[model samples]
Target: MIWETLVEPFAAYGFMRRALVGCIAVSLGATPIGVFLLLRRMSLTGDAMAHAILPGAAVGYLIAGLSLTAMTVGGLIAGMAVALFSGFVSRVTPLREDASLAAFYLISLAAGVLIVSIRGSNVDLMHVLFGTVLALDDAALILLCVVASITVIAVALLFRPLVLECADPQFLRTVSGLSAVTHFTFLALAVLNLVGGFHAFGTLMIVGIMILPAAAARFWSVSVGGMIVVAAHIAVSASVAGLLFSYHHSLPSGPAIILAAGVAYALSLVIGPVGGLARQIPSRPRTQL
Candidate 1:
């Protein structure tokens, strides 16, 4: 029975399989990074970096003529450069991290729009903004696999330093030297995942998938490891369910997946018994009323 449903769809159409696999791969790559981003209070940076890749993707499409490999590389490079430059500017100047991030994203957004306008038509712009998951080919799949593996390995190896930096940057810096490299590496991995997910979910909604599930998982778990595990599971489940829903209903998979993640986030915000909004609300109400 399971084979019957999957066989017809998976065998009949390669795009379906690619989309499914790519979604799952992105979740695995992104969820842990999201956890650290939240812990470090850089949640907004994730959103900013995701958007910052748009121009790079557009430029890649223009130069390489719509090749996914080129687009992914372009996005990765652009994201890393943005991360480095923002950090440098913030460190050297009086501007805060948030200010630096805002500048970076605005510049990238304008550049992306201008470049796409000059080099390609509206269809190319649509593909960059809305994405083309159904258009993914073998090369993109291979790139996703490589990126996912690197993300997993990077997370496993740097988990301790990353956590220390996120939870207590001052203490970590004082005791074990500045964890700047680890922090940058973490951001780089996150940007790569965002690029990959851009192809799956587009720039506008990638942050919803990257941060929402991880944020939701935090409400359910006190331990960081537990949160990471739960977040990854939530992301994978949402992706699979969203894909199935999109296939049956003829909806766009990216938005469907993001909505599913948003639901999970909402559920976590309200329903988790310990530290959830439900628990916090009643105590405050009892005091006031």
Candidate 2:
């Protein structure tokens, strides 16, 4: 049966199991961080950080081979560098955050491509760009789990301050001693999560996976915490559906996964009860006397 072809391989292959696990792990780490980034209006920074990881990953592959540990370490380093540099530029110059982020992405992408081309040979640039989840190894799965766990814990501990600062930085400054330092620290952790998911989801699709679910959740909830929970659920559901579809249909996993999220986003945009397209449409006013 066609269904058996889809279900059987996942049961038969450990790689498939690992791939599924990795997707779940990425969802856990990325979804909450995505919500915060969206609130901060730093969504583009997340995208840049995702692309910035490529050069580090390529360097890691060149030096230590294609091991997951090497690539992850490289990615983390590169992501942090980009995030820090962006922050520094924003603080020191008149350029805005989005402009700086745009510059960072282009430079990082060009650097990554140049490095990969020079190092050359067996590297699959497309894989780095789009990801291939079915090829995940046990080691990569474990790394994903570890990174997800850390991210969850970090977010949970900082939830209150982060939320307060995100919604009203000036209010937090007036009430508490929250500084730019704390803001930078939170951004750093977000960059880490984005980089952590890069290998599994790729630069091209990471922004969609990170932001779309959170954006969708915003339509369904008024409370920030509630939105985060909803976003996580949305992300997990999309990942599972995409994984299944890819398994059955022989499609690339990243695009399938992003497409699934995109559908959710579109649905939320149109039919979501609150602040959705339906609600945003100005009701026809009765003619006033």
Which prediction has the highest lDDT against the true structure?
A: 1
**Candidate lDDT values, in order:** 0.84, 0.81
- Model 1 C-alpha lDDT per residue in residues 106-126, reported as the tens digit of each score: 888888878888878888777
Candidate 1: which stretches are off by over 4 Å? Answer: 1-12, 285-289
Q: Quick one: best TM-score, which candidate? A: 2
Residue 228 displacement (Å), model 2: 0.9
Residue 252 lDDT, candidate 2, scale 0-100: 81
Q: Compared to the true structure, candidate 2 yields what TM-score?
A: 0.91
Q: Over the full model, what C-alpha lDDT does candidate 2 score relative to the true structure? A: 0.81
- TM-score for each prediction? 0.91, 0.91
Q: At residue 143, what lDDT does model 2 achieve? A: 73
lDDT of 2 by residue, 37-93 (tens): 899888888888888888888788778766677877888889888878888899999
Give me candidate 1's TM-score against the actual structure. 0.91
